[model samples]
Target: MEDSEIDHVMSEIHLGCPPATIGPFLSHFTFSSYPLLDSSNDQSMTISVDKDGDLLLPRRRRRTSPTSHSHGSFTVTIQHSITSTLPDVGLQVWKSELVLSDFVLHNMSLLNGLVCLELGAGTGLLGILLARVAKAVFLTDHGDQILGNCLRNMELNSSLFHPQAIVNVRDLNWMSEWPVEVTHADPKPFCWSLQDFEQVKSASFIFAADVIYSDDLTIALFSMLKRVMSLGCDKVLYLGLEKRYNFSLDDLNVVANGYACFRRYIKEDALCDHSDKKSSFVGKRIDLKQIPQYTKGYERGEDVELWEIRYLIEGCPSNTILIKIQIKRPTNIFVESISKAYQALTDPGFQMGIALPQFLLDIDGASGGILLLWIVGVCILLPLVITVIYLSRSSKYTGNYVMHQTLSAYYYLTKPSLAPSKVMDVFTKAAEYMEIPVRRTDDEPLQKLFISVRCELSLDPKNVKQEQAKFWKQHPAIVKTELLIQAQLTRESAALSPALQGDFRRVLELAPRLLEELLKMAVLPRTAQGHGWLRPAVGVVELSQWLIRVVNCRLFPLVQGSLLESEGISPFLQLAHFSDAVVKKIARKKVKSFQELQEMSLEDRSELLAQVAGLSATAVEDIEKVLEMMPSLTIDITCETEGEEGIQEGDIVTLQAWVTLKRPNGLIGALPHAPYFPFYKEEKLLDSACGCSVEQRVVLSWTKVEP
Candidate 1:
């Protein structure tokens, strides 16, 4: 090569990570394939692996596959790997830092000329990125090595900062108290200044990325967030995270222990708003789709996410007591005393004949305590259906039938014409239009049911824009239909006489072929609307309003939910024990949901079944069997390393799971009544038939290999 070409090539030397191990080294995360900005800054980031100056480090086998990236990127110096200990793991450029950087660029308007501080700012890439717009940026972290590396990276990206940008590198330990006195001796890289402390306390925004991993470290981080976020003036914390999971012996299941630790801080309403009554940290997930991936190169996998959290101004002080709530697991006596049939039954594969959702719907809210069992289909345990208790609700629910009935009720009220018990209307309309036999009855038991989060925030006028930005996740098919309809309308409007552009449906009439063109892209289904049904009509309206910020969209491939009734049929009937005559007698009572029955007291249940509901004593006995099987089990779960109290990423921690079959603590009702959540002492008498006391424990190991 010529001298000029060689000079140009040398100028473009950038960091190169080996495939053997993972590094915070140069990697790309592309949310978009199209160019949203000109002049990519991430180019020419050459860190030579051969030499120190040629800081290009050889890659090692990474724990996961390398992600891709695209448009408007940046580069920085990163350590090949950790040299000191756990905290130094921050030395490398974690992908979370890059992911958060994209959000900063997209929301530059909010950060422009505002005080911003980054929590545990490892490599200073995120803070440096913020330096371009933030009025003042404090890149905070502990350790002289990481602090110094971050400072150097600041100089490396100095060209990217605003002309008057003030960037400070300082020490902030998560374990220490707030306003940590200046611990750095003279001549060290960073020391806390009074002014810097004030700036941090009054900052407009706080950002942290790739900071969560260890169980102990997560607690420390949460404590820091609570303390720092509470002191500041109405500041929002944008956290970027990647879930790392592991297999454990305690539950003998793969679990994200560190992530689980982090989730304990979230309240049920946290996802809805930044101001919640339950916890100080009110957080909601920021949809990645709303944030453009302008800094391209990496594939933003599903596990990676960003959260927008607000520390409620009226929150309790930092000194608020930290209650360690752990619901105790059931004892062997508790489990064995409840289900003697399981021990005595010969067939291990005996069908429970009940779906998990049906069981959940049967009982009213478990407000007292929850009975959690480890339910496994494996015969290794010989029909030991352990009820594992989980205090926290999973963020995502992936069942087909759970919310179907609710969905039907919600969507029925959407169109005034379809208001009362018109769940069957959705199907009849489609069947009438297509002239096909509607193989689905309203009571046919939904095959693939989808129950979205209730329309609490979606229908609210104040949350329109935010709801619009996130609706794609819930109603993809409906949104697609809207997109096609809009496209066709736009095309017809362009071809029509200006006067004819007003009516989209009229334009469709004007061009009969346009209707046929649309049918080509139809997402059709078979019996039961191809078995894809959505409960809650508001969910449909919410989706349409989100895409157009208005309500003119198609509602196709969406069906309503139905109720389950017990007849003489086996599994088809919800209550397999009830005969056809018994079902008719129970039907006269008009029990809308099983929760209605669950909420009744013992006397009410007996009277309603035998007298008011016109049921015989035998039928009442069958009702008791189902209710007796449900023990509001309390699950006390915790995780820690062999000797340590806190668990960090990569540290294998024992996840201890304990389940209780009855209320060992809390209220013991006088009558055989339905014990609320966490307490179920009254139900124990139902298992009098099974007196054998046996404690069984089974363990399995799963070692996942990544290629």
Candidate 2:
């Protein structure tokens, strides 16, 4: 079929428009473009992206120091959404893109008068900058929304480019075949002509920013790169990637998975023998310090790395190898090789149409009798081994472990002769108190990580509720105040022996001093102890809930998930003062929030407390008293949806959500959310939150609005 004819016969499928709720906004990046070309060079450049709301980018609070020099500059605006699901995250520009922009703008001469292509041009902010010096630029990406936004940006910063600069927004689907067969039936824009296709083939450089994130996408990107670069060995790809570390289950450690995949495909090693030179792909990491940061906004974290990649035609032509290495272990030998031989032959991969030699088939045929016996042995012994493991672990109960460990450590810090060393000793024993081994091997660092994470206390306004946000910011001694409060609260519940009472009381008297060590160690945020990047991801309640979840799901079927389900766990910090175990039992049940936990129709609170292990009568009563003081709120919601013309796709509609909260008996007034003064729309949503005492509120009072 003629290519032009295919364009006419087939239609292009672009992703449908995203919801209007998450519509386009603008984000501006202002920076100094160095080395002025002429008097016309703009020293102050502002690049705007489509991501503006009440909040700005990461370095919004930071301003550039005044510079005396004038240089080249431009203001670029991009149309983008602030957030999207992982797969469609291309709709938003990322931190790594800004870092890459600074690198490119700083080294402008390197790209002088060259033609280049961008793999994932996303909004094309970088390409718009490239168009300034490049002869021709291909702003390519997949998906309709991404391309549409990229084109919009191109139109926005048209003045930034020279009159002769040629920039094209085109389709580059990584998963699809390259040299896109655009037929006459295809109605999509940016269909390439034979000449344009040749220009892309001859383009000297390929630019990509923050494109390495997902494993599948990384694989597809390299696949496309191999095909494209194979056509021309002179081609070099500039990849500005941010290594995002995550805990990998397989590796049992934190790793940059996307970056690891990229490394595998490039096959580049820091130290290698002559055999490495025969590898088809070569990669080199560029020193970031060598490139001055031209853009001002986000911090260029250490995780950001830039690589210069090239494909070679000089390597072994076939680049394919099959391997079978000998394997043996001292612990166990498969003397039953007769039965084990079938294990490999029955694999799914072996089921493929791969042919086997006659000798291998003869060996497998000889193992039939032994294989039958092996299966029988596994069926009988597997059950017994599981039964023994389950019986031993389930019956074991580590009672009041958290209390014994934490208090025991504090026993030393509260002494009259307490020294600086004593303070450090307490923290060093933190993991031991938490029941984590003091001498753990390299593989068991995950539990220690959880302890540090659980200890995090975010005082950031964005993370905390509006009322509590101001309190933490205004207080000069936030750490001291918080630590003192925690100590005071816990001291009341902690039943101490007479011998331990004096030292423990001293701890309460000097509570604020405790937080100083944590702050000094950088374990907690410095001045902005309450405020941070986002709402806190961990707390005592979260830690408690996590443990309960793990304990509830034992390997062997037990008396866990079989129990009654919980309505929800209230996000209250006061409950943590009672210890994580106390909160675990509360979260395990309860038809309501913290306030309603006392509303159970039991004869007394002790009746319910009895179900929880490690609680005395006095402690049970104390918990009940705390629950009574908490704020109570029950919610009822009604939604009304209707249209005179009937609701249809693409039609404007109103979504009205009527929310009402059932408050506790003594409250009087229409405003159920009067807890905070000068009520705003955002604060109005707090009407549904469980109210806490003033002290408890600052610790934690999370609210969610269903409407």
- Tell me the tens digit of each residue's lDDT in model 1 across 1-707: 46334321100112344535543344333333222432243464455555445556432211211242211134433333422245466666666776798888787888888999888897787786788888899989888878877887787668768978899998888999887776445735587867788888779899999777778988998888888876757687899987867787886998866788777775434344432344566677888878766554455678787988766544432223222111243465567666786666756776566344556656788622333433323442434433222212221111421123323433342342332223222321211122212232411211111112122222446886665566444333333223223434222223432322333333222222222221221222222423222222332322222122111112211111222332111111223244345444544566433445555778877887788657668877876665654334344565545433344567675666655445322343333322111122222321211111111112222232343
> Candidate 2 on 1-707: residue-level lDDT in tens?
57334321100111222335346767665556542222122345455455553442222121224442222234566777765556556677776777778778877898888889898988788898899899999988888878888899889889889668999998888888877776777656876766678888888889899889778999999988888887743688888988877898988999886887888877453542324435466778888877776665456678888887877554532233111112434223455575588778787777556454466457847766655676577777788888999877554422432333344444433332333323323433342223322232311332322223323333354555663445434322332233322323322213333433443344333322323222223222323333331222122222222122111111112223422223223233334234335555655654224444545654545666655535677766655554443344333332222312234344344443334433334332333221111112222223223243122222222222343
Q: Report the lDDT of model 1 for residue 138.
A: 90
- Residue-level error in angstroms, candidate 2, position 65: 8.2
TM-score of 1: 0.36
Q: Where is the poorest 10-residue window by lDDT in model 2?
A: 7-16
Cand. 1 Cα-lDDT: 0.51
